[model samples]
Target: MDLALKKQILQKAQDWFVESIAQNHIKNTEKLIKPTEFKINPFTAVYLANFLTGNSNPESIAKALVYPRVLGTSITTSFGTNIQKFTSEVLSAFGSTTSGIDIEFIDQLDGFKKYCQMKSGPETINKDDVETIAKHFSGVLNLAKTNSLRIAHSDMIVGVLYGDSGDLNAHYKRITSEYHFPVYDLSPELVPFS
Candidate 1:
């Protein structure tokens, strides 16, 4: 990435992270929810039981604080997902095609145009999601193929926003096994998947 673009991305990231956390906190606590009103089991409660210790009162207070915005206000929402998606907007500022790919940028080293499907992290996907991602990447490749655009697989990527090589889950392994391109990790390299 160029310096100006990098700076812009950093600023965007800061805005996404800081502002969204504040927003999530606001949305979650929009009403004064008491501990008594907090629902213990969400429909998938049986599955989530393993993670819970049956410690209610104190823990329920924590749960009640976030019950209003359960899915919308997680770590994934605050950090990488929006930021990665935000790159599409940033890339549009350049004369780049913002289609099929979440991020498209000219490689600073090789001067080749690199394509990416930005993911929050390695843990972001499931078995079905792996196939969906392959289809997404395939759509990009086949689109290029039909137009006679010589886009190399080496230039295509599943960019994970954080974590190291070790943090990569089975879902990521499954992607690499099939696609055989980059599953870039931002912590060690430059990708996000979870």
Candidate 2:
């Protein structure tokens, strides 16, 4: 990947983290928590909805919500779990129902199948692929889904920032090594705070 492209993607990922934290804080406020309706960026909404509703088929939803920089490529299973947990925490903080927030990959695939079938697209997902992806992410997803209710809702900002930082560090290391470039520290100056 071009250095500029990589930097841009990294920045976008960071921005999401900041936004997630902000949203988390807003949800935590007692006044905001009781509101029945709210708005989120369309992309965030998709992930939030999936986590809250536990939609199994996320391909279409993913397609709709995935920031282009993170699309198509395989993400470590841990990232998936983090996202599920993050979504659940955010919803819970806002006093939204989380009955469907469990991150069962099989269920997500089932939903993806239904979505793909309805959209007049080739069925690009297969059981093997789902299993492979799920295997990669199962640990994180399982932990997040199972322990979601136990997480302190007040930690949303810290949790999201920590998760995003880890992922960005990993991505930076991967790209630097892949391109044989000297790894530069991701100084705060290089990334936007918001």
Candidate 3:
């Protein structure tokens, strides 16, 4: 990443950490929720520390916070499935069968899939692998990261709206008005049996 992009990402990460902490505090009070009652099961302290310090193991941090393990597993599984489909599509687009692919690129793709699946494993995904996958896919990783962040932040807003007993339609209108992004009443249409 360029210096400017790195700075932007770091800034965004920090902002997200701060906002998450604030949201957690507000939810704790508003919902009359004891610390133990948090549905997500993650403590903000460990989560924020992992993001800010970058020294802590993320999985260990998640464990310490009692973060929902299933979420990570689901994300990893979804990513793996998508990657498999993407790899096949890319190979087909290149007019080459998977069997005829160069060994080096094939090895890289296998490693990438393994890396995605090992989200909960002790082995961290290599930065080189991330870069390689990002480069190979013509910015798909960049798009994914951007979309993921937007979804997470929007989900936070949805939580706030629900907790406050705010009008769902009004909240949706406000989100669209402020961000110009249509967020409400949107359900992804997944292909059947994909």
Candidate 1 worst ten-residue window by lDDT: 87-96
Q: Give the clash total for candidate 3.
A: 0
Candidate rank order under TM-score: 1, 3, 2
Please give the lDDT score at residue 36 for candidate 1: 59
- Residue-wise lDDT of candidate 1 within 132-185, one digit each (tens)? 777877877888899999888777777676666787888888888876767876
For all candidates in order, the CA lDDT equals: 0.62, 0.33, 0.32
Model 2: which residue pairs collide? 56-107, 56-108, 57-108, 57-111, 57-112, 77-137
The model with the greatest lDDT is: 1
Model 2 bad stretches (over 4 Å) = 30-194
Backbone clash total, candidate 2? 6
TM-score of each: 0.64, 0.20, 0.21
Poorly placed runs, candidate 1 (over 4 Å): 1-12, 31-75, 78-81, 85-100, 187-194
Q: How close is candidate 3 to the true structure, as a TM-score?
A: 0.21
Q: For residues 1-194, what per-residue lDDT tens digits would candidate 2 score against the true structure?
A: 46876686567556655666445444443233222424436666666557755662655444334433232222322244345444334322222222222321111212220000000011222334333333333443455569773332211111122222334333233322432222211222222112
